[model samples]
Target: MRPSVSKPPACLLLALTSIFLNAQTTSQPVISADARTVQLERRLETISSALVAARQQVDQSLQQIHELQQELAEIKQQLPSAQTVPPNSSSSIADPLAALKTSVTDVQERQDTLEAQVKLHDQTKVESDSKYPIHLSGLVLFNAFANRGNVDNIDLPAIAISQPDGASGGSLGAGLRQTILGIEGSGPRIAGARTSANVNMDFFAGLAYANFGTSAGIVRMRTASINLDWPKDSVQAGLVGPLISPLSPTSYATVAEPGMAWAGNLWTWAPQLRYAHQFPLQEDKHVQFEFGLWDTPSSGYNTSDVLRSPSPSEQSRQPAYETRVSYGTSSVDRGLQVGLGGYYSRQHYPYNNNDSWAATVDWRVPLGARFEFSGEGYRGRSLGGLGGGVYKDVLYGTNPVTGAPAFVGLNAIGGWAQFKSHFTQSFEANAATGQDNGFADDFHSIILPSTATSLQLRARNRMIVGNLIYRPKTYLIFSPEYRRIWTWPIYGQGNTADVFTLSMGYQF
Candidate 1:
């Protein structure tokens, strides 16, 4: 019975068996959840490690940024402060542009100061050199001459003390007429004023083999003077010859004809004071004027007698005065020149009784490429005893009376003319004539045999002269001259003389 039950439940038993068989035929593999969870943890750990390393790099960068900020703060602290510059600031401030400008300014100021000082030094040197100056000069003259006699025979003594002889002769001679040496100089200003002076000496030697005995060796003062110049004019004082007289056409030197007479009367040196002024007149033209007072020597017989007896006292006699005015024209084409001048002079004798006055006119004419001629004429008058008087007296007798007494009267006239021939530039000719008259015939007669006699005297005198001069250069002059003089009633002796002479000279 059981077997039947165990074997059969046919539907149930078969379903169960079928299910078991199907499960076994379609089986699937399976894993634990814990193992998966462990893998997940490991991956998460790797990710965390990477994140930590990134965070570390970021922190390091931040630290480097903080250090850089500190360094920037230190750099800012080292920079200059912008505070106002202290008054006593010794430490230089940092301002490149301003410093450069200040340096440039200082350098410029120093340079200007140096330049000013140099300019001052140069001006001082120039002034000093101008204030003090020196000069030197000299002149030498040589002369040759010939003479012809034209006079009545007269007894004349010889140098050997032999008896007087009546001998007529002619002569040719040579001489060193004058040798001059000069020095001039000036001194620096004192109290804004300057001073100057000049001195010169001359040596005159007599001719040899002329039969005329003379003191051959002699030294003389040619010029000596002191000058003081002001802003407008100048003054000079010294023992000087008559400057105006020499310049006048009728003066002694100018009137002395070739063979007639020599210039300048041998007289005592006259001391004088003079003043001169110069001013511009017109374009390239000028004018100059000068005046002076001179001390006239004694005229009357006394130890101080200069020319004659009855010498006037200084206080009673009027001072000798001279004046000159000159006008110079402009230097036109080729430097031509024209001039005009006038002069006047007066003198008083020691006796106060004799007075003299003179007037002169001068002229200069130039012919272009031909020559130049200059001339002058003077008129002189003497009143009272000045007409005539004894000039000098010696122990034995008396010298020729130049300034004589006894209604003395004098009239003198002279002139000179020069010409240059076109044929020779170095060749020139000069001629001159002079005349002096006393008109004292009546006075000479009354004075009869007395040396002071003035009546019956043919006082008229004549001088004729000529010169042919050859100038090789400015410094050399070769001249052959002829001079003639005719005197009537010579010295109240009713005698006459005609003299001729020739001369040559050199200059440098």
Candidate 2:
């Protein structure tokens, strides 16, 4: 206990000295909240000094009380009886002990109050530094489904164009495969530019996911990117959406429907490096010019066997190039945006050559506060690498000219439009339609033998979708959608299927 009294005073004295030194070291005449912060520091210094002085006085008083207690104990030991003791001696001891107890209580109370104030001050400092803080965002999704007709690979199956005459039945299942996780951060400065970064992933991809059922799913990368900007120019690099299709419709049924991918929606994500510069027209209004170079989409290795078709990577001889010019009144809600873009890429063939390209116009116009219209349209050849043309790049068959197999290129036209209405802050509805049509004549142009009539190629895909969204809170959403798809393949007349979907999600 004696050592404890000395230790508290010594530690508090050290703290007071350190606080005083900190106050002296800060000489800036910074103003606003900074000035207030300095003022608070100086006040803390004063409080620390008072705490040290009071602790020292308490230590001294405690030492005096200890001495008195020893004296009183000796007095009691020597006393023959209470009646024989001198009245003033006994009274004096009792009086001072009572006062010492009061003094100790007062010191304890004062120390507690000062410590609380210091804690509050520290908390205030932490809050002030917390501006531009990092936050976590993404969602946990649970989906339950029953299909009247079988679809392509399952995890989040897309509409399969297989002829209805096939032996496939139907399926029923539930899963958390669409659950997502992502981290978001901002307020970093880089090379004299403002920088922000985000990374997102989900268990919706992998070889295992191709047959994901009640089994656990494998994780897949969704987005890993960074954006750095100056006042008028910006740079972005990562796995990102192509500028050929700049608008996307909101849908909770993304996993199953893909919003409108195989239809008129040219949707694809690839690694790319992009730069954007803006010409200011007025306040919050500008014309933005963007140019980007994307990784050469590979159409895997090619083989002479026509049965073993080339993968996307094998089709590319060089990286894809794209540029877009768009004008916008603002980027906020109810704003208007319109752009025209183009894409080009060269393809490599064994002792042969092919080229692919696209030209498109994309736009969004808000009819009013509650209604909007948006879409993109493009014409591209061998664009299957970008999720168009039903994933078809070329038609392979016998060549009458060379008396060998030939790879004939294919072309397609695609576009998707979404009309949306927001009836309230918590509820909205969307209707969208799109189509990807392969050139029928181009498919017929392939020099195939009369005996090679078994090729069943897709000629067209069409989709019409309508959905309603209900958001009960900022973090929770519920949506149900109905999608109708019609597909035409050279093998049969056409195949049609209807997909109904419901999804629940919570974002943080």
Candidate 3:
């Protein structure tokens, strides 16, 4: 301003200078703000991309979890109830990691179980294990039997039909007619209970030959039944042991040795429907009650032998009933057992109606370490099927004037006792004696011919048997036995028989 010496435009000069200063300060701040906006946009873009990727990954994980759950459900359905997952399982978690962990654990458990199942199935299918669950049972036996007098066939010796004393010579035979085979099965459970079935067969089929009257044996059904096991209760239906005589003295010598007709062993097989209930009294001790309705209590007799071994088959219109109550020391039959039993039946004859009844008691005791004793006693009338009353179910006599048949019950008493000792794990010995007594007056009243063998109904029948068995293994046995049988005629001299037998068996 001094150089130009201009004092008139000082205001204009000041305004121009103010404008220039404002522009300089605003330009620097605009550049710095633009740099910060660019940086913020880059960070936002990165965050958005990460969120989208995470959503896709989570979707895939959910799909995988769903598939896994479906598989687990399928596995559960196929598995038996015994392998059911626990209700309080922690697999219901919400966290993905936790849920996945649970799924993995469940899958592993199911896999293990499935593997075990597969293993079992594989084992069962093997030739050696074809009957794994259905375990093969029973024995194969050959017997050499010799008798003092001619008797029945290879198996049982008929005391009544035996040759009268001093009338005939003795008999000897060897046979393989006592082999036993059976199949038993344990299958899938039902209603929280186990189910089982069995079919037992033996070669004791009477007097049958394969061809040309050869010794080739015929097979017979011993027992075939199904068992449903529930808690403390069971139901059985089929051909089974008689309720009145559930236990028999163990015999390897001959199948007949256990219950030879005159031996007072009231053992038989009949079709039956039975129910059993068990009540626990204390540790290792319990009580059981059983009852059954059986097939008509017929003597299974026909024309030839009907006179003496008569049963009220023609009159037995109603089923036989049996009931039993027992106390035991253990679940298995190894310990003491005591029981009482009853039987009732009715005969509906066109002209006569009768009731047959019986009361029985049985005991099995374990004496000390290696000894055992068993006994049974029964009182009844006309118990033909049970081998009592001289094997006559009901007494019959002809009405002298009416020319009609009449029947009366025959009073009877019977008992048996057995003692057994296990000399060692591989050796055993036992003795048994039994008797059946029938009222002699009833026999005398019958009108049949005096010489007719049926008229000689046994007033007293007794048997004693002693045996020793050597079992090198549980499935193999060798036995030798001696048995003496005696029968008293209703009014004449009695007859007796002596039997010697040797047996060898292998059980499967």
Candidate 4:
């Protein structure tokens, strides 16, 4: 019976198998549809990427085209006009494609050329703006001064007597006190040596109530010198002004009294040879020494003909010999400077004998800005021999009152102190005392004497001076001054003169 029931078992099994195969076949179509959807998504992504890349390429191409067009325009402007172009056959000129190619090539070449030219121009500008060592500079000074009371007459003869007393009120005058032009240059060594030089001149004119009429004018050599610099050394030579004196180091200030023996009497010019050597005392610290040979006499009673007279004999003779020494510290904070100098000259005139010595001390105190003080003392002696003595007695002495030596020795001592305080940026003041012996009495005896022989009565005299200077800027200065003079050995009785002066100076 089981066999009969199972007779369909195999067939039943086959039927089950067939049902499974049909189900599997039906699932394949759905799987294929999903695969097609994925492929379509991938293709869309690829197309989007390609579109973005194409847009970027188009933008870059447009930028290049814009630049090329600008270059083409510039090249056209530089091309020759019809007047410069040679006539050609119509067939040759009709080839627009070749002409366009040629124009494009030319524009490219011109753009490259212009870029190179701009670079060259920039390089040239940089070179021209570089700093050089050569320099040209100058200074001009305009001065105006007025005097109240008696002013010393510089135009009178050196032997003239009597101070002029007229028109004591006021006067107007103008002058170029220091008209200097010069050139300076420095550079690396050439042929193992360095060289430099400076040349200057002064053209001056002024008006005063004097014998030279209402105006006095002159042109003089201010400075002429050449300097040679070695590794740490230098040498200079020429007709140079004195290196001494703080006020009148370059040129004499002729506005002051003439005969008084301070800065005025110390004024003179001479030829000199000078040498300087610098040595390092420490790192960034140095000390210098200078020595000079000033043309002058050795000693005795001989005069300098070049200074006193222009005669050939005088021109060749020396005037005097002057020596100077100075020492300075490397540290400005140390505030120390000391110097000593002297001169000895033979009498230029028969009875004139001259010898002078001076010492100076200057100190500075470190404060907010700085405070400075300096003092100088000088002494001089003039000897009058027998002939001078007789001249003095006859001119100044009463007849037969007593027996006296005709000649006498005249001695003078002078001192001055200067103090400056730099308290603020806008203001500074300087006060000085310039007084000497033999300023007034010599004037009365020699200038305003009652008799001709009164010239012999010249003796030691004194002048007291005070000055206050205000400097608002580096190039502008205003000074007001006062002077009092006292003469000794009264000839026409003791005479004194009080002088007040105001001076304004501008420089650029």
lDDT of 3 by residue, 60-79 (tens): 99998798888666545534
- Per-residue error (Å), model 2, residue 438: 0.7
Which window of ten consecutive residues has the lowest lDDT sum in model 2?
A: 124-133
Q: Which stretches of candidate 4 lie over 4 Å from their true place?
A: 1-139, 153-194, 205-216, 230-232, 243-265, 278-289, 296-319, 330-335, 346-368, 382-410, 438-502
TM-score for all predictions? 0.52, 0.68, 0.69, 0.51
lDDT of all predictions: 0.47, 0.74, 0.74, 0.47
Index of the highest-TM-score prediction: 3
Once superposed on the true structure, which residue ranges of model 2 sit more than 4 Å away at CA?
Answer: 1-134, 163-168, 207-215, 255-257, 298-317, 332-334, 400-402, 447-456
Candidate 1 segments whose C-alpha is farther than 4 A from its true place: 1-134, 150-165, 189-195, 205-215, 229-232, 248-269, 297-318, 330-352, 383-427, 439-449, 452-458, 490-508
lDDT (Cα) of model 3: 0.74
In the range 1-508, model 4's lDDT, one tens digit per residue, is: 6678876988999999999999999899999999999999999999999999999999999988787677655555544341323467675577746645766787667678789868864563322122434445555544444433333432211122344556444334444543455555554565566866666555533443476644344545655677777876777786664434322211112332222333223433456677767776655545556666555322123375346534211343554444555555555433445656554434333343333223332223333344566555555443121111111211223223344322223444454555665444334454444444433333333233345333344443445455555555556666665555554344455445555555566543
Residue-pair clashes per candidate: 27, 11, 0, 19
